[model samples]
Target chain A: MNIPTLSELTARGETPEILFWVGCAGSYDDRYKRVTRAFAKILIAAEIKFAVLGPEESCTGDPARRAGNEFLFQMQAMNNIQILNGYGVKKIVTACPHCFNTLKNEYPELGGHYEVIHHSEFLQQLINEGRIKLTDTTAYKGKKITYHDSCYLGRANGVYEAPRAVIEALDADLAEMKRSKTRGLCCGAGGAQMFKDAEKGNKEINIERTEEALNTGAQTIAVACPFCMTMMTDGVKAKEKEQQIKVKDLAELIAEAQGLA
Target chain B: MIQQILFLLTLLGFAIILRKRIVQISRTIRLGRDVKIDGPTSRRFRNMLLVAFGQKKMFSRFIPAFFHFLIYIGFLVINIEALEFIIDGLAGTHRIFAPYLGGFYTVLMNVFEFLAVAVLVACVVFLIRRNVLKLPRFWSAEMTAWPRLDANIILITEIVLMLAILKMNAADQILQHREPQHYPSTGKLMFSSILIPVLEGYSTSFLIFVERFAWWFHIIGILAFAVYITYSKHLHIFMAFPNTWFARLQPAGYISNMPVVTREVKSMLGLPIEEPGTNEPPGRFGAKDVNDLPWTSLMAAYACTECGRCTSECPANITGKKLSPRKIMMDTRDRLEEVGRNLQNGGNGLDDGKSLLDHYITREEINACTSCNACVEACPVLINPLEIILELRRYVVMEESGAPASWNAMFQNLETNFAPWKFSAADRFNWAKD
Candidate 1:
């Protein structure tokens, strides 16, 4: 499969429909890289004209700002805004809730305005438009799948329904964890918590959240955010249930169900 | 006439004290940095109605919400009777409204009596929940001695006040029978009439004394409670309205940008600055003390009811981490009180070598937050403890450069490589290479 970068598209004198923001985690984390590919595959299958910023896409400075380094955060934000505004980017979609949140909500103030949509919402839109069709009798058919709400996506942005709708489109039983949606527990990796070890606590936050997910007796834990993907995968491993249950992103699940993976 | 004069003096004295206390609180809140909180007025008014007056968020916990609603309605409705007390005290008349309203007055007294009983029951249950059941929320580390005592004192005081009103009503009913000239019949009240059996067989003079004593005690207790609210967490009763009205309307994840840093960065990048060249000195990067936070945040600190709802919902606190969101608000309020006291004593404010940072809250507590917004979502009054955490973190990282070593490395990687990890930006598209 051939994927075009924004620079390549610009040189070819063509503009794609949406700029796919492959966040720091999506680009660098080995496990999350697969999610990036799976989501890209879905976009290709749907014939959506999407291009990536690739090397030109810097961090959205979500971590910097969250960690209280405003000077560094603004420096990075201003740099990204210059590149994005120069490209005349009008729309952005990302698999990372942090990037989606910063670009959609925080960027307009810094003058990088764009309609930012999380990948889950984008996927739901694709399915709703019948752009991507799933094959019958897929791996998740009649199976119980639980979706973990990323704090940035759930309570932070109030985008709770789009991801759930995407999950339901798979013809699978969507079992909800005890704490989901507004009261959903964090995966223990926000506010730059992903970069540093957790402070002294009785138990890890991801483990607690995983316990809630496991209590639902679901066979798969579906996530939308790459950060939650890493944390929940670690949690499933910690509980020694990696073999019995699998942690998959919503895009990966839809891609596999569509026979595109 | 002498009784009327004495009542007027007491009322005037307490009103002055209450006004002074409120003024002091407002002044302390004003010490915080001013930030414009412009938003749709209708939306803010709607938020106040739903969250504060409507008690919408409280209903999340049914049992407690039910009891709290009882007390809240009781406080509002019973105050009507307190208004009558003031009037009767001023005119030296008995049941002044009773002559005009007649049957409706009995209905109003019966409703007030019913609410008094409800308040009495709710307060007892809350006292038991705190002391006997020992709900974990009320016993968190920050609850300490005084907080626990403060909660108990208020609950017990409410119970005592309710009983005093009932006793006064019963004595009045008995005096109406014996000395109709002084205590004219206002019809039998429902819940208070239940106490008639307890007050029966008492002499007319004795009954009048009981009536007068209970009346004085109940009114004085209410006056004291009003003054006490300004100093206690119960300030939420009044502050919740304004706090909810001025709550942050943006998504919970949106940490407000530091415009000062924005201007500096714009100049460095050669981007046209929005407002160039101000005469004011550059302020500290973030909050080191209460005065550094926005006035809304400081007001939120004063408005916190110390219910531990935020703490109970906090992931860090739930996991046994040092960061209790309740403690953050409590400490902010405590530090603000200290500064207020310092200013009142004619000493330098915020210069006593004490601050909200290490003095009350610690670096460890602030670092533990995941910025999950659980506490913000859990807050019944729209308090954002995460905002406070973020402000303090800005102070630590930018002003003090005291982030943990790992975070510093992450910041370094973000600076050079444009990511948190030490990977080349060139490798960003390698994920698409299969």
Candidate 2:
């Protein structure tokens, strides 16, 4: 992946148009790595000069903050803000709402100010600008696809239209769940709940949320946030319908439609 | 003169009980750490009107909302009758306002009668909903015997109190017809007039006794209810106003970073840290006890109606997690009350050694929360359980170093690698490669 680093770009006295924040899930989670690759490919295809923080990028400290580790969250956030300021980064695009939300909303208080855009919004913008073209014979054409709203992306930040617009650009039939948009249920990986063992309950939240998605009868469940992708994918597997129902990130769906994957 | 002396004693008793309860509650609320809650005055008033008086959030569900509205309006309007009762009791007079206002007083009594009936009906329906219908949220693991009994007792108390008013009116109407000198004929009481016929055959003395007994019972019950409510979820009747007024005006999802912790980080980073006069060695990172939380949060605890609206909407509770937002509030209130009692016994602050975190609320319940803010959004009175949960989690992580293994690893990755992964941050952009 010949992705340029801000440090490298700064060393060469060059600046990318946008900084690509490959969040922990994008950079590490095996399933979400494809989402990272797919989004990167879209950026390359659109001829957008973007650079990653590379080794300089750290966790947005969202989980730490949510888990109530204020000291750790501040520690991590301060380090990232210093590095971001050092590189003179202005605008950021990331594949995770957890990162997008923190960097955009939280870091400014700690003196890290930048225009952070979630990948869904960024993809919608690219499509609107006519930078990328979708052709016929696409896998998603006329297929029933349902998008799961990540809590951070949907209710937490109200970025509902962009992801749906990006999915609509694929010419796929979007199936709306009973609980969608503002009423969307969590994929169960939000807050710091992703890291802790779920308390005793009659059902796992992911299973219930996945049930809502499957009830839509969509062949493919689309997710914008990497966390949602992981959760929904687990949900699909739990229901033993992995072969029938495919869980893919919106970027992957776009990558497939544009033949960038 | 004897009647006036007895009434004064009753009034004095009520005042003393009310004063003691107010002092206790104010002391408990004072136990919380100070967090300035200044905001636009207009916005605060608007929130109180909308959430508290308007019952805006309750309307999300039609049936319960209707019943709740009836009870709430009934509770407020019936207080008018209480005012009249207090005046008549103090002056040793019967129907003092009746002759002054004439027909308007009759109309006022009718309206009060109508509201009392509505409130009675609403309380019965509420009792059924809690006990007979067994709403799942109400029956959660947290809704132990005391909470259930407390709710039932409140409803039953209101029912008896309303009946006492009607009985008193019925007996008084009969006495007025027989002996107009002693008991003035106050025209006709709407609901109680029907009961007049039921008590007509009794002797004039017996009728007066029944009227007097019912009147005294009604007033005493009112006084007792006032004090009992402080110990019950009914505290929300009063706390909702202040709780709604002090609610966070910001978006539900916006989490506030601690300024004290922020300063420590800036200092570590060699940034110009603003030192605000070293206050008790930077005082613990997050809330380990009730004293560590913001005063509004403690007020929220005291204000919880235990309606379980937050738990009903909670994703964690729905998913079978141990977390119940209602329980969090209940635990907080319980701990505050305990601390208040400890202080009354001459215990010196949090030095009595009991704390809110372990003694009242468990780490398991707090950990199960997903921080979705559904609980906060679901609460009609604007109580933020997430705030309390987050503070406790902070204590676990910062003070006890008791985070789960996976979380600790992620923390290590965040510290050393700048990401929540063991792989180097240098490989972050590798996803861009084919």
Candidate 3:
């Protein structure tokens, strides 16, 4: 269960191949913390040399920027970039699409440049590299699992296939919602909505999106973003179908299938 | 000779009006801040070809797209015959290309006839869809009186124009039969020939009058439409090409970084700035009006055809939130026009005590956006309403610090604790302890 931080690795004059950016949501959201642990477990099982920023890692300012507070966003971005640069980190992987998008696309201009990959793509890479192996008969074999495309991961960046590929590797039935991929519905937590009440609407966007997932007849709704995990889970509960359908992160599913959980 | 003089004068009048409109629209769009959209000319060209010329995105909805394709192709192909009309009017000749093109002229005329019929049918179907069937998109809150009437007027105008082409051809066919020397046989055009039976009973002189009247009507109608489009949402006909060409090629999710804010942040942090600082006073932190937006954004405002596809696909609008992306574009265009007229009347531009933010688009609407880029993705012409929303939101938060109270707390937490929540950074990896 031991996890190494970048500082610990650096104190020993060592560097991990990749830095696991446990985003604010991944770090604190109780439900999403399990996803963080699950992804960490998969990395350990695959023997990938990675370390978390832990106490040093700060929010990537995705929320602040999205909330239209550029000053706070840049301030946080600059501090994080300085820390990442000081650690000489060259590559990053995270379970949060928000962090993945900001660190990958938005940071280079702010002087933080690194090869950033979402955990979905990273998991697909691991499975492709034969680093992570699933048992022949896994927990989700032939089970209906629908992956909700996080707006950040799917339309924002174009990483639609990797998460589905990871789901396919579970030997599960991938039921796509009517609106998915490039046309994917937002889980309603984007644009800093997660931190605030939704402006009054007929229904919560997550409920609307979850209805699509439910209509797909998928027993399990899979997600890559922590925000989607929270929203979809709340949606399933709101629909009173939590007992019938479960929402799990891609990493959690992979970790379970690999018996690393 | 008298007819030729009248035709030239009419043409000159319409051309002057169209030119004036084009110049005014160009100036209004230039009122926006200049953004350097450079390099990668090849990609931009491909985008314009596929989105504008190819009508690729229209196919997303099969039925409407099929009918729209009819009108789009019909309009472009029929313009070829208008070229002939212009040449004939200039030289005082009837069917001038008939001798040179010979049988091919008949074939070309037949194709134009067929397209005219198609355009007529499509316009009728569009009219029915708008008024009869009442598609929700065409009747959104922003689609008040003028927009709804404007749509119907364009469709009805197209129908009239298409009919004129058929009537002109049908009368010309009869004239050719009676007076071969003056009328010269161009052969029977398919769709228009159906009208020959009805017109066969008319007197020869009356038939000539009908042909002349129809010709003038068709030509004048097209000229009027060309000028009318600059004032209508139909501006998409010409603006789509330029708008799609200059579309933000970056991924839909990439909100452009403000270099001005970046430099200021670097200075505040005591970090060495890379680019030299400007001595000129920093402009407003974000867009408060159309003048504060990038020129591409303003062009997008003019380019939007108010199809409501963006609004229909919008998550906020779908859930009955007041945020309609289509309304955002329409409001922007309206505000820009107001500003343009204000400036023209010698009033201060963007300082007429009316701004695009609260005056046109309300804070409630812009704040309702999920910033999911659904509107951006749904746009067939690549208009990013999300970009406009973000810009306005930036203005609200940066310039006025007018964010909702809860958001202010989130910002404070992000500033102090490095996360939206007040949780300490030390506990970041507490889950690992398990």
Candidate 4:
């Protein structure tokens, strides 16, 4: 896979249509790295000339802001915004809702104005435009799959349908947990909770959320955000249901249906 | 004549106590950082009306909300009777509004009497809920003897005040029938009418004395309760309006950017930074103590009813986390009061040798928050305990550099690699490379 950086494209006197914000989790987390690969394969199949930030990208300082380190958050945001503004980057697509939310909503006020899109929305757009198609006899077809709503993506930004639309594109059976939409429970890893230990609680939030997903009897738990991907995966492991139930990102399911990954 | 003298003296005493307490509260609130609360007036007023006056959020739970509404309406409507009581006390008159209001007076008194009994019942039910039933939310780690006792005292005070009003009406009814010298035929108090039949067998002089004693006790109790409420969570009765008025009108999930940090970022990014030359102190990044919080945040602390709705909904608290949003507000109020007392005792403000950060709210509690804004949403009076939690976390990160090791590693990665990973930033797109 030949992925061009924004800097390289600019140096070549060319510009891509969109900048792929490969967030830290997608860049480094082993599990989420698969999500990144799956999403990139889908993007390539869609024939969208998207460029990655590569070394120019940094953590969106989402954790800093949530953790109340404003100085640090501003420092990081300023650095990334300056780089984006330098490239005249007009649009951004990220796999992490934390980055999608911060870049789309919070950054404009901080002088970083760009059209930000989460990969789930991007995948749905691809499917809607007929750029990517899924086969009827795909591996996940008719499989019981439940989508877990990430707090930042669902309640924070109200991006519920796009992810589910992408999931439906897989021709899979979509079963929803009781707490699916606005009332969806957190997967024990948001608002900088991913960085710290669970603060001496009776039951971890991810475990509670996982139990909800499992109760739906879905063989596959579909997620859109990398943070939720990490947390829900950990939850599945805790339940020791790795073999029984598989936690997969929507992008991964799509890629499998398309024979891309 | 002597009675008039005693009434005036009592009025003066109440004025003194009320003034002293008001000064202390205002001073403590003023200690917080200055913030621009003046904006979007229409929206603010709408929130104040809905949350404070309408008690809109409280209705999410029906049973308790209905009972609470009774007391709330009673407290507001019955204050009309206090106005007449004040006028009668000042002029040494008996039922001053009785003649002017006529039949309307009877109807008004009847409503007030009915609400008085309703308030008494509601207060009794609340007391039972807190002490006897022991609702899980009210029995958290931070809700020790003082908060529990504070709630009980407020309820007990309301109950006694309601009973005094009823007893006074019952005794006054007897005195009026007996054609006493000063006792006037105001009207029948509806709910308190039951007490008249019971008191009918008593002597006329004893009835007059009972009426006078109950009257004095009710007014005095109200005055004392007013002053004492400033020191209690019951201050929400008054502060809720302003707290809700100054509430955050933005999307619940959006936290505002700090101006001080914005300028510094602008400077770093080669953007046009604002030129600053003012007598204002240097901007502190986050709160180190209670004074570092915004005035509205301090008001929120005072307005907290210690209901623990925030904690109960908190993902961390449900999982048995040490962090309780209710505890954060309670600790803030407690620390603010401590500072006020210290200042009152002739101690320097700088050397209280303690602060809300380490002394009251711990590192464990602030770090545990997921910043989900659930606590903020659950708050009936619009108290954003998350703001306090965030401010304290800021202090830990920026000032003390006291975050856990994993956090420090993440911070370093963010600084060096622009991500929360140890890999080179150039490797970010490796996922796209198969």
Candidate 5:
């Protein structure tokens, strides 16, 4: 039972409770949910009454579509559209880029459309609006961390700064990947790749991406995409940097600054 | 004497045919990518001079490259010698016009003849390498159905070209004004016998007669080969320049925007939701027909040299996933041919056209691709597989409704959970360890 559906929001006169479309990466990866929840709390404490999706929130048909299961993808897309329309939720927020992309881009195929923003952009907006206060000093105030732009978030949707802004806002030392922004290398997680194996290539994309971050001498690895965070975390562990470095999402970084974590 | 000139004119016709074919192929390959421009201005210019006129890309493989260089330079330099010999025959007299052309031209022609010999030797070695030694790696290129025939034609053409180049020297040696009747005895091939030793004790008249006879043979051979090459897969000589030049401009990540699916001609706006147009719309969002494909899709067939580089790097193919990168091009070619064949009988392809996804490619094959872009990268021609596959997926997801079982559940979960899995949407930030 999802109370935050688009229809219910419109019925309740909250024309935009800010429908949060949590992606499967965020759903299964509990760490990301914390980030979203923290972002959500900003809206909540602001009395914005942000509507968080529940049981009705599922996978963005992207994985299905990438898997060539277009029928199932459209069904999911159509179902989600109906869910959004029923709730009359015009604006949606997401921590996962894949969800943001699928809903914002792929949903029209199934006839569902809405105003969608990446959590970074929404948070940046909130920060700009002065709804959320942050300490100029963060846990990683002097620590160097590199931010990996997720393919879906940065390349597909062009949401580069919001996450970086969050990191910079936290007053953390930031580094860059060689192939950042438009040329950002895939984290071996696009087009259903996270669910599959690395095909023939020089390096596993996560490791390759991790190596880029590592090359920046960033001790802490930060990412917005759940897949990127997980993949980078795994890459760090494999490189035996588990003891030397740490991985954190933007939400967690913001939360840390506020002493919430 | 007049027969020699007629023969040279016949050869010129052949070169004209070849030139026409190469141009057509160039145009066809230009159609494949979505706005591919080769390097920067200087780079394109340099590449055009080097790759197109200079034959630079061929040098990537040394043996073949070496031979091809010789043949190419050989013809360019000695082409006038063959032409002049034809004119001499037509004039019904033989004067040493080649020497009168200028000392530099005479020396350059001599050097070109020697290089032509090198080219001949190189071609033979390459042919042996490909056919007798059976370099299995080249099987992809060799197995290109029509390409194999083209290869044979190229081999014959090269042999003839070499004969022509060698004969230019031969005709000069055998048919000059001093020794016009020595054609039978002065038949020496520059490719086979080194000119230094063969010129020993040879009379000047014999040399001129040989040169004249060889000149006629050379012109006919070069022309015939050119015409044949136009319709062949080796059409890359003309096609590769533009194909490599107009590689994709953007990073591989840019997915082309899907067309607006609207009912009316106008009224489309950002955040497409309803039919904003004045006319009725189908409300569907994916390409439904060949007409729906980006023009790039059609261009793929021409850009494809059937090199199999794409198939070689394809993970799906290596994993036995049924998708062959070469076969994709072949399939495209087959469809185009079918369409053309049907059109010849006064039928539009619409009635005969079938969905390639369901016909040539199975659902399993489509699902098997990881979309890694290895095929895209490995392709010497740089055919972007990611875009093609995604478009196919769009058709599947939006138009066809075909999908795997687990994939279906994933989509269902996406709708229900606002994600792709069975988890709640609230737990996204639970894993922060820093």
Candidate 6:
């Protein structure tokens, strides 16, 4: 749970336009952490007054909601609401669909409402708004990037193009997984599935989804959800082909191209 | 002739009354919460084509399935023949011997009678499986509301018609008209020749009376079944179409947004659901009774063929936890009727303005749901019990109050710690930490 204090929000006053929700996924892994940190820097350079929601932000209770435990969901919803209000926050941007879904959909069910945005959608808006420019074109070696859409973000929220637009902005080759967009396969992590042991099904859902990514001949896999990033990265390691392919969250990819070390 | 005509007219009028009652029952039951399923739509359509038309999802057992498929298809196709029989009989064509048939008609009647007997035999086994063995758990409970004498009536009716058809076939050939010496049907009922001569030497009035008796019984028995089929859970005959059409369009794990939160006002002790007024009342988070459900949820009850597919696939029922997905749908239908009757007069009949749990859903039954959505996946008609369970959980948590202590603590932990685990909220990203 990474949260911001009210004093910081109040100090910025009616002017801070962005609140970077460096989600559980972005904060957990080092490479992703560095990349998201760079994402913050890019937004700051783009003149977006963004503050990190650190430590006070908690899990989005998506697992509880999926597990049919509404008590737990309401608890998380009310808590997030209080914290967001304490910061006097009106807008939020996050990378994980799990968090995005909880904040966007589940919160209202608990009596709190806030304007929420996914990081890809935010980046697309920034680029469209001419916020940041890529320093170089065709810089990275071609690694046919394949994107895995998170279920909550794609099917649940209907946010499709912004992520694609970000990938296209890279001028890199893009291939699609067998299941993507609205029909995206569950990474076996939705509905508190991340908390419970995988039930009976041929092929772990996340691994099966990853194989679809690998089938695209993409050496690198990019993800929007922190759970997906972690799951796919773990999947890549399990096949012992870690030395050959790499997993990157969207922000890290943007940061790498920005020449950030 | 007067008694038979009066009996037929009386039965026809009775059928109209029964039809009206069943439709009213259907409307009342289909009035609860909205249920959404994520199952594939094309699969449901494809399956119905195979099952209802091809009789596909029926028992895998060979003999019964064969018999049932024949009976099912025979009843459907042979409907035309029954209409012809009724029209001819009503026109005063009560013949003492073969009247309409020119030899060929006799053989066709023989074949039709043979098929009808085969279907009836198959139906007897179905009755045994349901009543004697109690193989389908819901079937026995479902039987309570149906006419108790149905099984006996169906059996007696089929046997009598079969014998009468056999008698008429052979009698027409010997006493009335003779031709087609090498016919296939004549050999099967060849024994009827012994009885035909005894009748042949009799007066014409006696023969005409016997023929009228057989005609009346066959026509009346089948039409009664048609009306009965619409009145009961066996109403699946008519309801299966719209029921299946409403089934979840994807897989079971798919969830459509829920419609309401239901709570028994008597049992509910927590958040007061602001009555629907100037403010948008906080949406109902769970279901407390049949009335709490959307109209579509009630429609799901009617659509259920009482196939018990949901119960058979339910992991909860397998472990003896006492939650039958089949029973949930059946119970909803039953409760709807019971409750609807109570409310039909515009008063809370069973509740007395009290909580419905004392009579409706048991606590243990409520807890047994895994929310696995298996029942939804297995159901061809697409009733989502998971949504109902979750909505019930919401009512319990927010209003009726008290839940499993483990869930309670986890709910608290969910507030401060991002995970249900007691870990600090800041650690939500810990899994991603290398």
DockQ list for all candidates:
0.87, 0.59, 0.83, 0.55, 0.14, 0.09
Clashing pairs counted in every model: 0, 7, 0, 7, 73, 38
* Candidate 5, superposed: residue stretches over 4 Å from native: A1-27, A30-190, A193-261, B1-101, B110-129, B132-136, B140-149, B152-156, B170-193, B196-217, B262-292, B345-350, B353-362, B426-434
lDDT of 1 by residue, B174-222 (tens): 8888888877678989888888988898888888889899999999999
Give the per-residue lDDT digits (tens) of candidate 3, residues A56-152. 8899999889989888888999999999999999999999999988998899989999999999999999999999999643689999999899999
TM-score of chain B of each: 0.99, 0.96, 0.98, 0.96, 0.71, 0.74
* iRMS, all models: 0.8, 1.7, 0.9, 1.7, 7.3, 7.7
Per-residue lDDT, model 5, residue A198, is 45
RMSD each, Å: 1.0, 3.0, 1.1, 3.5, 9.2, 10.6
**Model 6, position A214: C-alpha lDDT score:** 85
Give the total clashing residue pairs for model 5: 73
* lDDT by residue (tens digit), candidate 6, B1-434: 67658656856786787777676676586566444444577877776676555655454436556766777665675565666665555554433123445465556555576576676677677667766876755353433544335544554555565566555554544534332332223333444555676677756556555655665666676666667655455666666666665554532433333323212221133544544333446554566766666666677676666666666655455444566666666666767777666666777754765433435566556565544454664554456665555555555655665555655665666656565666666564453233
Model 3 CA deviation exceeding 4 Å by range: none
Q: Alpha carbon lDDT of residue B207, candidate 2? A: 85
In candidate 2, position A118 carries an lDDT of 92
In model 4, the runs with Cα more than 4 Å from the true position are: A1-19, A37-51, A115-149, A154-184, A200-202, A215-222, A250-261, B180-189, B255-271, B277-284
Question: Highest lDDT, which number?
Answer: 1
Worst 10 residues of 3 chain A by lDDT: A132-141
Colliding pairs, model 3 = none
Q: In candidate 5, residue B371 scores what lDDT?
A: 58
Summarize candidate 4's per-residue lDDT along A138-189 as a digit string, tens digits: 5977888999988788867778899998888777788999866655777878
Q: lDDT of each prediction vs. the true structure? A: 0.92, 0.86, 0.91, 0.85, 0.61, 0.61
Comparing 1 and 3 on lDDT, the stronger one = 1
Compute the lDDT of residue B401 as modeled in candidate 5.
60
Better of 4 and 5 by lDDT: 4
Better of 4 and 6 by DockQ: 4
Q: Model 2, B186: alpha-carbon shift in Å?
A: 5.4
Which sections of candidate 1 miss by over 4 Å? none
Per-residue lDDT of model 2, residues A49-77, tens digit only: 99988766778899889977788888888
